[model samples]
Target chain A: MSPVSFFKCLADDTRLHCVLLLQHKGELCVCDLVDAIGESQPKVSRHLAQLRECGILLTRREGQWMYYRLNPQLPAWAAAVIGQAAEGNSVYLKPALVRLGKSESQASCCD
Target chain B: MSPVSFFKCLADDTRLHCVLLLQHKGELCVCDLVDAIGESQPKVSRHLAQLRECGILLTRREGQWMYYRLNPQLPAWAAAVIGQAAEGNSVYLKPALVRLGKSESQASCCD
Candidate 1:
């Protein structure tokens, strides 16, 4: 992604939440994200489109569900923004992180 | 901000760049961001507005210029996403971060 585009992607809290949902889990469909984040399906889909356009995320389709994950080849500039973001303060960021981890474990064990 | 909002903010790449621009410098106006990110004036303004709404950023107006910074009290959920974002791969995130640091140093020494 271009420099400005990265900022655009990260500007939305919902998008950031969706990314967090995808982080450990690898991929998720719009419905899955809706359940994970508890939002309307359209909202989740819109944010997913934003994430894909920004290039921070990638997608796949199986049957009818589209899944997304963190793009592995992080550019240095985008990487820097993310580097510091993790360290900054936020009340919701931590708890959501905990839940995301929990979900991963549950899915892994079930699989 | 709530979990969904944070992800929404982060969904846009341009917004991510602006936040990174603000991360080190403490604050920035729409114009400064326009210059820093090399986008149009109104575009920067709109993005700034988005950041402000998401609560990942805080803003101030001095004379005609409105400035913004990373909210110091980032929710844990947001912080976790950022933490992983930095570690995850993005091409733009790193170089933009470098430019941001360079600009800060230049300004500090000048001051």
Candidate 2:
């Protein structure tokens, strides 16, 4: 991806949050992100669409659920940047992680 | 700065170029950037203003020249991200860097 596209993909906090969550979680479904971030499903989905379009994220379908993760094809530097952001912004990320933990502990529709 | 602000500041190619240039050079006057990036002086200045307003960059003036550099106050992750981008995107950055080298070799208005 072009460098500009890389930055543009992450320019929004919602998108940045989603990318960070995926970095920390490995993978997550739309429902998981919605729960973790406490935003409307539509809003989160829109951001996810932009991310996917920018090639920053990839998605897979399992049954009726879609799971999103960072695009494995990402350059090492881009991946490292996301990794650093996740590690360095733990305080900002804690709430989302907490919510994700709670959501995952319960069997969701993805199951 | 908010994570969103961090990304927002760099979402555009022009702004990203300016930020990466600062990351590579440490400090540069607006004219230096104009010379490096081959963009108009006013255009480069506009992007620099946006970067400065976003807190991603800091500026200082000496005599008739105003120099810009990455804001030292940036979080470790933010700085690392810029560093990684510069390293990984060297091919895309070479033209600008080449120009910077040539410009610095000559005594510019900044001198």
Candidate 3:
């Protein structure tokens, strides 16, 4: 049930879609999440909260908006999950993440 | 934070330890998890349940026992997480899982 929850948390296309957006992208504002995931504010906010509560993401309040980023506490294996999912997806996600100082040109796999 | 939740689900040493045992081992009973992770039966059961709830593991009922195996529904990325963590540890995990029709030689990385 525990591990299933982990996968279930990730199983959602919207949530995974949101995660791939924020991952390695540094801090992203709620506006960006809404834009990228194309979901309503309430929907995105709820998903973000779920991820935050589980410790997969961290947030920073800047001015009137909160910025989200991948938390450093995640195990190294978590990176592998991101890499595997975003392997071919970097073409779209990398460009979007360029503003965040991350370049996902290719998924870096262990050699 | 959605991604963070995924990491937190896997954040526990006990759960990760149990996951490694089931990843490619076909199916395992709770007893195997207890033996491999050296945790109490309740602890192992909870962890296994968590994994199942997350859609990472699947369960089946035998004559008197329930067998757990990695869920095929997991995204390919999940396998990478397991591979990354078990890269160097397969020496131990694989031998223990041979009874489950699995072999641990070396981690296979994408080239």
Query: What TM-score fits each model?
Result: 0.49, 0.92, 0.50
How well is each residue in B37-99 modelled by candidate 2, as lDDT tens digits?
A: 888888989989998988889999998899999999988888888898889999988899998
Clashing pairs in 2: none
- How much is the lDDT of residue B77 in candidate 2? 87
Candidate 1 vs 2: which has more lDDT: 2
- Model 1: CAPRI class: incorrect
lDDT of the candidates, in the order given: 0.65, 0.88, 0.65
Q: Between 2 and 3, whose lDDT is larger?
A: 2
- Candidate 2 residue lDDT tens string, A2-102: 88888888877789889999998889999999989999999999999999998889999998899999999988998888888787889888999998898
TM-score of chain B of 3: 0.73
Q: What are the per-model numbers of colliding residue pairs?
A: 72, 0, 24
DockQ-based ranking, best first? Answer: 2, 1, 3
Q: What are the per-model DockQ values? A: 0.22, 0.81, 0.12
lDDT of 3 at B45: 92
Among the numbered candidates, top lDDT falls to 2
**Could you give candidate 3's per-residue lDDT for residues A1-111 as a string of tens digits?**
243345555656567766787664566777777765566889989988998887778999877778888877775555566656565356546544553332223431111
The deviation in Å at residue A46 for candidate 1 is 14
Put down candidate 3 lDDT per residue, B1-111, tens digits, no spaces. 133444556667677767777765566777666665667889889888987887778899887678898777665555666666565356556544553332123331110
Error of 1 at A41 (Å): 13
Question: Model 1 interface RMSD, in angstroms?
Answer: 6.7
